[model samples]
Target: MPTKTTVPEDHRDDARPQFVLEALREHRHFVMCAHEKPDGDVLGSGFALGLALKAMGKTVHYFLDDEVPRNLRFLPDADKTQRTFEGIDPSALYVFMDMSDRARADDALAAVPRAQIINIDHHLGNKRFGRWNYVLEAEAATGILVLNLIGGLRQTVTEDIATCLLTAIISDTGCFLYSNATPSTLRVAATLQDLGADKDVITEQLYQTRSFSGQKILGRVLDDFVLTDDGICYSTVSQKLLESFGASHEDLEDVVGALRAVDHCEVAALLKESPDGSYRLSLRSRGRVNVMEAARALGGGGHFRAAGATLAGPLADALDRMLTAVRAEMEAERARG
Candidate 1:
């Protein structure tokens, strides 16, 4: 077993920040990896860190397990990211940011050889899988911690870097509307704005620039939406629906958020069929439910308010089993009262 080191929220001051800074200084090259299905939080923060490393005159490789979502293609220098490792430097630093598990980094993660890994994330359920775990549950996104490293390195948070970090914060926090959004989060946003992060353009690009394909998929999801008497609203987007709408998997990304917006919904779920026939499940809570717990029970994990899991499917059957677990948890919560 790899020895795990954990940095709790309170102790995230100078010690762990220095560990990351020192690690970057000691290594000449780095292969930076983010979670599969690279969301804005992961990709934005990853790119921000890559730019910072390049600015310091260090060589950096941005690798992803999944292709960038069509919506986020406008992110800073996203074109440079590679799906394969062109050259492996055994000594090159492997830095996994914004994700909890190494497996989430990609299938290629297992093959990549690295002397050291610095795990940086904000998820409370993180396994402390790296040599250096600088995780702070208090942070809305890992990008906040990366900003700390930039400051400690005495590097500047240039306009581009600021924009990337700002997107990470907003994407993970639902534009700072989620419960995890704190006063500090707003402060970070304000600072990013003052640094010229262009909130108007970033928000427009992220939320408003939806494709017509995405719109049709969203419509299908909402039209078939179902809300149970217990306040659990559930739905599915089958492969057939996507095929008919000319939509891709990425278009279904925001559908769960739309489901959560339904009035009287305590928990909302969206399950989309994968090419392999497994269902990709996304769960969102209204703060009254711990959707993350449900996700973990189904072998997935995410934040308290938003969580996800993938399960073997015939979509309907998987939905039944998972919903049984979620409904039971809800019943238990009521029983406790």
Candidate 2:
């Protein structure tokens, strides 16, 4: 395939991708990673790129200390992900995907030599803490950037690679329902399909199928949903509630997105209790609200419409803090108008 197939004209002048491409060719071994508790875009992008490198006879290690959500286990090479960077070559280059910083991959990866790191992400305000940073906030998913890199190498995207890339685009775009799904995203999706991506498989596994326990847990979250007067819809999912339903954090994967879809809701927040009693707050917004700003204020980061933060919980206090940050972002957006 041609290199220009995925690289848009505006991105051509950005030399970071070329620099990263050179690094990929120079390295004999690599360790690919994504954020802890990763979503599809992270897993898919890592798997696709890792597979491509493997095809070139390069050694690739995928480090993912966290569990792969049940739905995403179908991704190519999903079973190959390592729980630790055990046996990693001392000279292996670390490729961080979808995360703004290396710490998001967990405490261990935080200390890796920055000069040996290749940061590829689509998050706003990325720290650029790597030897080569290919951060493009305008892209809907990191996989798009990976595709461009693969195309630059004149790689033939196999069926598995196409499937993984398509999943990344579909997952990050809410199956193309989110505002971030631009014409370029759709065109890329179309190209992947022509390359033999199984869209039906992706749709069936991600959307059509849902565990009974997950559905029940989602029910519990929505039953006590709170919609604030200013159009912020919020909910809490306690670890106790999850235990009662025999579900894990993965069950709540799409719950926040569902909340954002509610009528009159400009923003949605889900405060979930962790095993250690801390809280992970997931925020989503319809176009006007910049949930990322709220998340950053609370010590997190992501795109403008979607972001998250961690809180020390006595659940109520955490909820209060998250609400306060979100309300402040809402006010800021209104003031901008």
The top-ranked prediction according to lDDT is 2
Q: Which window of ten consecutive residues has the lowest lDDT sum in model 2?
A: 1-10
Candidate 2 structure quality by residue, lDDT tens digits, 1-337: 2143332323323335777787788789999888988888999999999999999889999988887788899999999988777889999999999988777886778779877888899888877777777888899999999999998767889999999999999999989998889998999999999999999999888887888888997888788899988999999998889899888887888899889888999999999999999999999999898999999999998888889999998988998898899899888998999
Clashes of each: 0, 0
Candidate 2: clashing pairs of residues:
none
Candidates' TM-scores?
Answer: 0.93, 0.94
Q: Candidate 1 lDDT, tens digit per residue, 193-294?
A: 999898988788788888888888888789999999888888998888888888887777778999999999989999988878999999998877778888
Evaluated with TM-score, which candidate comes out highest?
2
Q: After superposition, how far is residue 296 of candidate 1 from its true place, in Å?
A: 1.1
lDDT of 1: 0.82
What pairs collide in candidate 1?
none
